[model samples]
Structure formats: C-alpha cells, structure tokens
Target: MSADPNPHPTEPDVRPHVYDGIREFNNRLPNWWLFTLYATIVFWVGYWAYYEWFRVEPEGARSVELAMTRIDAAKLAATAAVNIDDKSLWAMSRNPVFVDAGRQTFEANCVACHLKSLRGKSESPTAIGPDLTDQIWIHGGDPTDLYRTVTQGVPAKGMPTWGPVLGPKRITEAVAYVLSHHKEGEPIVIDTSVSAPAK
Candidate 1:
C-alpha cells in the first residue's frame, strides 16, 4: 500500500528541509506569544539602559551605599545630641548593658594588640598596646581623657585613630568597657617615664 502524500489536508504544510528522519512544520507563532517575547526584549533593553548604561536610577550596590551613608549620618547626629563627659562616661561604665556591648566590640577589634585580658604590656612583655587595667596612664588618666585618647589615638605610639573606624557610639562603649575596671575616685598615676615615641 502507498502512503498518502498529504497526511493531514487541513494542517499547515511542512518545511522542505528535513533533518535525519524529522521534518519541521512551517507554522507562524501565535500573536500573543510573539508579542510577549518582543515585550520582554524591549523591557530588558530599557532596564539595562536605565540602570547600567545611562544610570538614571541607582542599581543594587549604589542603593546600598546611599542607605549606608544616611545611616552613618543619623548615627553621628544621635551621638552628637547626647552630652558625653567624665560623669557620663563614668555612668556608662557602671551600666552593664553599655559595658557588655563595649566588651564585645573591644574583644572583636582590640584583642590583637591589647590581649583578651586587656592587661596588654603588663600581662605580657611582648604585647604591643599599653596596659588598660593599670592605674598608670601614659596619655591622661581622666575618663574624658581616655575617651579623647581612644578617639584621637596616639599616632606616634602606633595607635590608629578608631573614631572614624568604630564611630562615636562604639568608641564610647569601648571606653566605658575599659573604665569598668576602675573606680571613679581612684588615684590616677600618670607615667612620665614613657613619653610619646619620637616623630
């Protein structure tokens, strides 16, 4: 028996080209599907131009950076609003919440130089930082002095300024943590033997 030339007379015609044993049907795609594909392409082009090329809108990274800048500014403003002095710092040292947070910050960033005990050179001769627990202070022994020293840093003594890195809040917390080891009325002995390292 011979096979029929037109398998389905009502269906669309097949393409002349055949690959292996398969033949492709020469049928036009539905308008809806074509429209969707074209629309997606156009949308992609517009999105790329808006975000990548033209930069009309901020992308993911830029958005995050802008958010961070705003947050930093807000934090600085809040810190500035609060009155920070010797009495205030002493009060913070007495508060367990502030001290605990300060301890976490100190352990994370200060342990490398100051050691976990915060005894620094007193605990170990090889320690780079000075003893934080000692009553003797190379810089100044007042609570405000400590805060100033931590913020400004002793560059000549190899201490990096932590104000910019930790921000005012964290630095205040860290100072409170250090102050927790001492009493408010304790005698402050200034160590005159060790001067600032020669510039």
Candidate 2:
C-alpha cells in the first residue's frame, strides 16, 4: 500500500486502534459535544446542592411531609366549608343533576342490596331489603331519619354505613334520590303473615 504524501504534521501522534482491519482515529471530540457533557455534569451537581442541602419550608417547594400536611389541611377546609344536612338533602332533591347523580350512585353501589327499582332485590324482593317506593320506612319517614339511616347504617340489622363508603356529597345525592320516590300520605301495608327482617 502507498503511504499518504500529504499527512498533517499538527495531528496527534497517538496510534490509531485497529480491529478487523478497521482503524479508529484517537481524535478530540467536537467542542459543542464536550461543552454539553461538562454542562450536564455541572447542572447535576448544582441541582443536588440546591434541592438536598438548601431546602426551604412552607413557602418553598414542598417536601413530602409538607405536601401531605397541605393536602390534609385542604381536606379539612373542604369538609368545614361544605355543610350538608336534611335541608340540603331536601334542597338537592329538586335538582335534576343531583337526582341523576344519586340514581347513578344507587345503581352502582346500592343495587346489590336495594335492587334496580329502588325496591327490594330483583331476585328476593322482600327478603333482602324493604321497598323504597313505598312511603313506609322502619327508620321514621323524614329526610333526617333517612339520612341518618343511610349514613350511619344499622349494623345490628344488615344495612351498611354508606356515608363513609360514598362521601357526604354522594350520600346527600343518594338521600335526595331516595326521598324523590316518597309520596306523602301514601298508605302502604306489609303482610301480617310473616315478619320480615328490617332493611
């Protein structure tokens, strides 16, 4: 093989590494690439120092504990700000949106026990739960009574406490939906043949 007659003298004297007759020149990387590599290393060091060493509290970027505290505070504030009672439930009943939400919530959550028609279960009508369409309620026929019965369920009886399971807003909607079915002065008589368990 003939040697190159025009070899640059300023080029590095470092020998080229050869593998399978392929030569790789030991050249310096481009300035931009080297600058970028250095910049990243410096950025990483600065980032580590700023976050780990110089952390500020309550005002600065929140730590995990501070974030959690703020979240809990927000929860407390929300609970305090929103007041839900019998009047609210009654008020909510008039709203079509709330009624729809309640219906959906019931269909999703309560259908297992209360069934689709808001009466007893579709399979065993009278055995599982009472008919909600009927004006008669074992736990007084008032909005407050219904709220109490639903939120704080009767453990002694088979009913579950749905208030915690479904949040207060949901419970309010549910109560409204249930009460929407109630017709005042509507007479309902259960069979005297068998005393079914209270729903």
Each model's Cα RMSD: 7.5, 7.2
Output the number of the TM-score-best candidate: 1
TM-scores, all candidates, are 0.61, 0.56
Q: Please, what are the lDDT tens digits per residue for candidate 2 over residues 1-199?
A: 9885548767645656777987666667899999999999999887777776674333344577788898999989866654566576677777899899999999998877778888784346464776777755676666777778888997766789887898777877888898788644466554433235635
- Stretches off by above 4 angstroms in model 1 are 1-76
TM-score attained by model 2: 0.56
What value of lDDT does candidate 1 attain over all alpha carbons? 0.90
Lowest lDDT 10-mer window, candidate 1? 190-199
